[model samples]
Target: MNIREYRAFFLDTLSKAYDAAEAESLFYICLEELKGWKKVDLAMNSNAELDRVELVKWNEVLTQLEQERPIQYIFGNAHFYGLEFFVDENTLIPRPETEELVEWIINENKGKKDIKILDIGTGSGCIAITLAKNLPQAKVYAIDVSKDALAKARGNAVRNEADVTFIEKDILVADSLPESFDVIVSNPPYVRNLEKQEIKNNVLQYEPHLALFVDDNDPLLFYRKIAKLGDRSLTGNGKIYFEINQYLGPQTVTMLQEEGYKNVILKKDIYGNDRMVSCDV
Candidate 1:
């Protein structure tokens, strides 16, 4: 089939699942891989064609996208903070809101030197690698419970050329964390079981639930453990950063305050969701 015809087919199939703009976006992303054609190629040559074998491979990709499979997973690559990271079923896809948290950490420690940072639940190593790349003067360590997830994170750190120490451990089962940290940041599983309805089908079907969910009865389970750990782990004037659940921002802030963390602040993502919280000892 020709480029134009294949584009039409791709758009029609994905439009049923996504909005017109999103569908078109996905369509061109497919063309870039299938035909090595840029967006301008579609506009410049509407009648480009493909061989039968090429069409078959393209068909498989479109079939997955039609099934609400994430494009990043299909491509095995995702961009975060202007760098590309490998992604797959083993790791959660990096999101833009998390980029904001990374940016905040970079901004918060722009001129600081020789500090230590720990990233709890560092799925895909997005936060840890970004911090390590930006703050070369700091020691960055990341821990995740899932070996599969840690494998992906370690690969990403190498690809990004960031120096990060990846540890395989479950924070929930641990009694205490290592001390002497100047900053601790985490974007742990905050989505309650009751909040599953709010998640889109693509995520619910394809993303790793271990990195996305928490107990319904105690939604703040991970946060409480991390907060208590931070209280014990951080040095004087050490800061803590969390990407929190929008539904429980106030409670999260209150919990941090009760843990003796001062200057607690809750902030929203670009989408206006209550997404980030910061506090210091």
Candidate 2:
């Protein structure tokens, strides 16, 4: 089919499952990924034809989208904090809110030198690696419980040329770090398992459960554990940052303060919802 006909067909197929804007965005995303063509390129050349082999591959992606697969997973990569990183079912897709947390850290320490940062549950290494790249003098370390997740994180570090130490360790059992850090951050699993019904099928069915869900009875399990770790792991004037559950912001801040972290601050995302917290040791 020609570019115009193919675009219309693809949009119509996805319109039933997604909004017009989303469908169009996905169309352009897939087009660029598959053929190195943008919306403008297609608009300028309406009669452009797809190669038979490329057409088949594009159809497979369309089928997955119709089945509610996340586009990021389908593409096998995503952009976060101005860098591209590999992603898969084993890792949680990096969210924009987490990018704000990274921004906060970067802005707060813009001129600081030789800082040490630790990222817990570093899926895809977005947080730690971004920090290392943005702050060239910073020493960054990331830890994850899953070997599969750590492997992807390591790949991201290599791809981004961001020097980071990846460690295979569980934060739940740790009382102190091997050494103190200047700043510690985490975007841990804070989604309550009971809230699964509220999650979209695209995420519930495809994303890693270990990186997304927490026990419903104690949704703050990771918060408590990581807060305790920060208490022991942070340097005397170190700061702890987290991408928190919006619904449990108050409780998250309470956990940090109760754990002896001072200057705790809860900040909202661009949408003006409670989304992140930072505390001083």
Candidate 3:
């Protein structure tokens, strides 16, 4: 089949499962990946013919997209903070909002010397690896409860050429972090059970629930535990950051304030949702 013919079919079929914009975006992504053809190339060579093998590959991608599989998962990597990290069902795909949390941390602490940073519930090591890559003088450590998740995170650290220590430990059951940190950050499981309906089928079916949900009775479970751990684990003047649930922003800030953290700030993401909270211990 020719490139132009397949492009029409791809968008027309995929749009049944995804919105028009998303379907179009996926079309170009696949075009580049399969044909090494950029948008300009596609425009100039719309009549380029696809061989039998290339056609098979495109059909496979189309089938997966129709099933609502995340394009990142289908491609085996996700772009975050200008780096690509491997992702699987064991890890939640990195979100842009979490990039804002990472940006805030880097902007706040980039000038300090020989600082230590710990990322709790590090899924794909996106936050930790990005920080290590950006702040060369900082020591970065990341911990995850799932060994499978940690394996992928460690590979991502190496893949990105960032120095990061990965540990397999459940923060909720741990006594304290291995060492005091200049900064502690987490994008932990904060979505309440009641909010499950708000999640899309693509996420609810494919993403790891272990990294996504909190019980209805204790939506702040990880936040509370991490805050308490930060009490002893954080250095004086140290700060803690969290990518919080949008609906629970004020409540999260209040909880941190009640925990004796100072400078509790609830910040919004690009979408104007209160998505990040940071405080000093």
Candidate 4:
């Protein structure tokens, strides 16, 4: 079919699954992914017919999108912290809020050299690799419980050309984390069971739950564990960062203070949600 027809099909089919504006956006994204054509090219060559092979691939992606699968997963890649990383169902897609958290860590530790950084529960290695790329002088390590996720993370490290050490270990059950870390950051499981209904279907259906959830009775379980680990593992003036649940910001801050973390600060994301917290050991 022609480019205009394909674009219309994208918007029409995706509209059934997504909002109008979002469907429109995904159309452009998928168009680029399928044809390597910019929007300008599509607009200028509106009536140009797509070759059968290209049409087939575009149809496959459209079918997946109609099924409510995330576009990033369909494309097998995502952008975060100004870098691209491979993604699959094994890894939670790197998010914009997490980018903000990375930016915060980079800004907080700018000009530091030869420092050690550990990323707990590093699903896609986005946090660790971005830090290593930006702070070229720092040593970066990432850990994940899932072997599959670690494999993908390792591949992502290579794809991004950022040197990072990856480990497969469940932090929740680990004896101890990497020691003497100048910075420790985790965007661990924080979604409570009680909040499951609030999750979008695309996420609940496709994203891995191990990286997304915690028990409602103990919603801050990962945070508490990571903070305690940081208390024991962080170096002098070591800092701990977390992308926390908005509802539990105060309690997370309290937990950090109780764990003997000083200078505890909870910061909001662009959306004004209490999404990040940091403290020094």
Query: lDDT values of the candidates?
Result: 0.90, 0.90, 0.93, 0.89
Residue 219's lDDT within candidate 2 is 90
Per-prediction TM-score to the true structure, in the order listed: 0.97, 0.97, 0.99, 0.97
Over 39-134, each residue of candidate 2 has an lDDT whose tens digit, in order, gives 788889989887798789988999999999999999999999999999999999998999999999999988888889999999999999999999
Candidate 2, superposed: residue stretches over 4 Å from native = none
The weakest ten consecutive residues by lDDT in model 2 span 226-235
Best by lDDT: 3
Residue 3 in model 2: shift from native, Å?
1.4
Model 3: residues with Cα > 4 Å off, grouped in runs: none
Off by over 4 Å in 4: none
Least well predicted 10-residue stretch by lDDT in candidate 4: 171-180
Model 1: which residue pairs collide?
1-50, 2-49, 3-48
Clashes of each: 3, 0, 0, 0
List where candidate 1 sits over 4 angstroms from the true fold.
none
* lDDT tens readout by residue for model 3, 1-281: 89999999999998778889989999988877778889999999989898999989999999999999998888898999899999999999999999999999999987799999999999999999999999999999999999999999999988999999999898889997899899999999989999999999899999999999999898999999999999998999899999999999888988999999998988999999999999999
